[model samples]
Target: MEMAPMTKRDKILLYVVLMLSFIVLYIRFLLIPGIENVQQAKADLTEAQDAQTAMQETILMASVNAADKNTTWGDLQNANAVYYSLLSSDELDTLVTGLELNHNMDPVSLSIGEAGTQNLTGYAAGDNAGQTAAPAGSTAAATDADTDAVTADTVGTTAAGNAILQQILAADLIPQYDQASYFRTSDVTFSCSGDDSDFFALLDDLADNYPSVQLQNFSISTRSYAAADGASVTGNVYNVTLRVVLCDKGGVQP
Candidate 1:
């Protein structure tokens, strides 16, 4: 068979048809699968990220629930009041009132005085006065003796109170006593002048109130007073000071 000669227009038309067929096959086989894979990957990534976020949210919610279950407002307030009493005056008053009530003591005339500061001025003045009042060698000796006696008395009294306090602590009244680690006792001094009987009565009341606490190193002083009618009440007024050492049975962090 004789072959027909191809024209430039026919060649061009043939090339166009071949290119169109290649483009159609590429779209159907290669482009479609590639696009589908990319779309599937994006969907999978989105789903994975959403699941991770949900898990984190669940963990956070569980933590919040646990915290709520562990603590209560009343417990928090009581804990706060314990240590806070050391810093606040009003809170300290409330604590004292609570203590008095617990001990069945009359809160009346029970004053919470300011914390004591070191009496450097009194010591200095006493030393100077003693030096000027007495001869050189003997003055120093007398002053030293007096200071030693006072120190010994104070130490002895403190030791007695501390022994009692330790027993009370061992009895375990305050569950969180360890939080109140800084315990102290001052020398007992009279608050005012009053009858000897009234002073003893006050001590008795205290003794009755706090049976758990042993009253040791106890002392009293008295003064005279007149009634409103201008007649003397005759040993009517009395002042008392008590030194108390506190102990704690250990429990709780705060």
Candidate 2:
């Protein structure tokens, strides 16, 4: 059989058809698969991100719950009680009253008692039997009975003092102490006497008055004076110097 000659137009048309077919095959078989793979990968990435976010949220919620459980109102109340038990009522009252009377002092500047730095050296030492003797130049000796009486009077004074201290604090007399700020030191001075058998009662009063103020450090010294008639004063006078630090829950102030 003799072969027929092809027309140029027909050959061009045939080539165009073949090219189009190949392009369509490429898109359907190869490119489409790759595109689908990319879409799947993107979907997977989105799902992973969403899951991670959910997990993080869960962890955050758990942390919040834990914190809520840790600091209950009961716990706060207990802490308050424990803190108040360290001082006497009369002492705290006196401190508040004195601060009220002192125009130069800012009552709101009062602070919580400092730890470790607080000192009851002279007071505690004086409570001992041999230590009860009035200092030199004191008019009367501190007898054992007087010492016992003083000790008895001081009992429970710390708690009462703390209660008053809290009231004063709530009143914001010393706004600084109520803040969550750190701790700071303050100096306090007061008077005492060895001659009075009820001298411990006076100490109790002082403790009750300033429960929030810690007696960080203290010194006891004697003083002498004359009566209005110019007669020599017959009693022992005590002067006390105290160093105290005020602290907050967060720590000491910088």
Candidate 3:
């Protein structure tokens, strides 16, 4: 083809077109990729922020659960402590002394017997209701006597339990008693001398003061002093004998 000489306007138009094409190539290659990278970075940052928030929440929940567990464990320990047995014989004696002191009572002698007798007979709690009828040879008087004895034993047991509770409340330290297959109890005997008013007051509230113990048997009588040939034996001595049973929540052998 025969070509004409180029004009300044034509060259200017060609230069403008070339510049536009170069600009388009730069935008597609460098600017577009950089913008895409910025968007990706923003998305990654948002994801990381979300992950951090979730982890913080998990840690807080774990702390709360640990606190709750500790509180529950403490409560469980306290409940278990309440069910423990007396610390020792000395502690038991101190408790007895406290009870007597509370009522201004002075006992002549106090004796605590052994446990683990395994001699649960009619005294087994909650058994009478479901018990089978007695054999043919059972007599009415014997039944009456049995009922009386059972009543006395129940009273004694109630008193003992109450006294033990009072002692535990007063004493800070506690010791656990060993658990056994069979039931065990302590037989306590004491003697006191008091006037009619004090003795009667004790008798009235003996079972009421403490719910877990009672007097198995008791006697109050006046003692007679030796009479010389002409001496006046005037002073009336007050004597009282009491027996109580202590049912063990924790069974012990000795």
Candidate 4:
């Protein structure tokens, strides 16, 4: 027996089957991958655009802040940096010696007291508003009987309160006060002898050079002495007390 001849309907059906398989392969291998690639490219482009926008905004803000005349943002930042600049004991002494030498003055004594913290609350004028809580390392100087009696009469209450204040500061118990508000102060007593004019000039220079160091007390007196040869010498002597203050508002590290 012989097989029957192929029909047109059978041929058309075979072509249709082949076309369907080709379409499925094209979509699975090529079309789907191309669509995914395009989607990823779009996402990356969006991220880059967002980053560029943020950069531009930052630059614009900086320019605006830099244009201010009275108080520029850069100046404020510099002030903050200076506010936190602390002076060590050796540096403080060097600074004082430099000033004395510049003013042609003879230094009699220079003492750098221990650094202490200020009281958060204020006191009345006679109640020792200016007194601070001495740090733990500070030692009270010994006084003679007569001087001790006078000191107790004048500052006994102040000293007692300062003791309590020191404990509070050591324990971090100050209410409504944080570390940011903490400021350290080191007292300096500098005694020197020079011409009155030179001493005044030195004070002016000190103010200009070190704004952080402030003059708290100033005393001047006349000194008369007899030399070995019996000749008398007279001059002016200056006793100055200064306070150097520092803060951590700029987030400076130790």
Best-performing candidate as measured by lDDT: 4
lDDT per residue, candidate 3, 123-218, as tens digits?
Answer: 223223222212122112122221111122232232223223323322331233322222244556665544567666765555444332335566
Candidate 1 wrongly placed segments (more than 4 Å): 1-73, 76-112, 115-198, 207-218, 228-237, 242-254
lDDT at residue 39 of model 4 (Cα atoms): 99
Sort order, TM-score high to low: 4, 2, 3, 1
RMSD of each: 16.6, 13.8, 17.0, 14.2
> Across residues 36-99, which tens digit of lDDT does each residue of candidate 2 receive?
9999999999999999999999898997866754543233333233232223335544554364
The C-alpha lDDT values of all candidates are: 0.41, 0.43, 0.46, 0.60
Q: Candidates' TM-scores?
A: 0.28, 0.38, 0.36, 0.43
Q: Judging by lDDT, tell me the better candidate of 1 and 2.
A: 2
- Give the range of the ten consecutive residues with the poorest summed lDDT in model 4: 143-152
State the lDDT of candidate 4 residue by residue for 112-139, as single tens digits: 9987776432232323344443344322
* Candidate 1 local lDDT, 60-89, one digit each (tens): 899786665354323433322211112234
For this target, which candidate reaches the highest TM-score against the unseen true structure? 4
Error of 3 at 23 (Å): 88
Ranking by lDDT: 4, 3, 2, 1
User: Number of clashes in model 3?
Assistant: 13
Model 2, residue 219: displacement in angstroms? 3.2
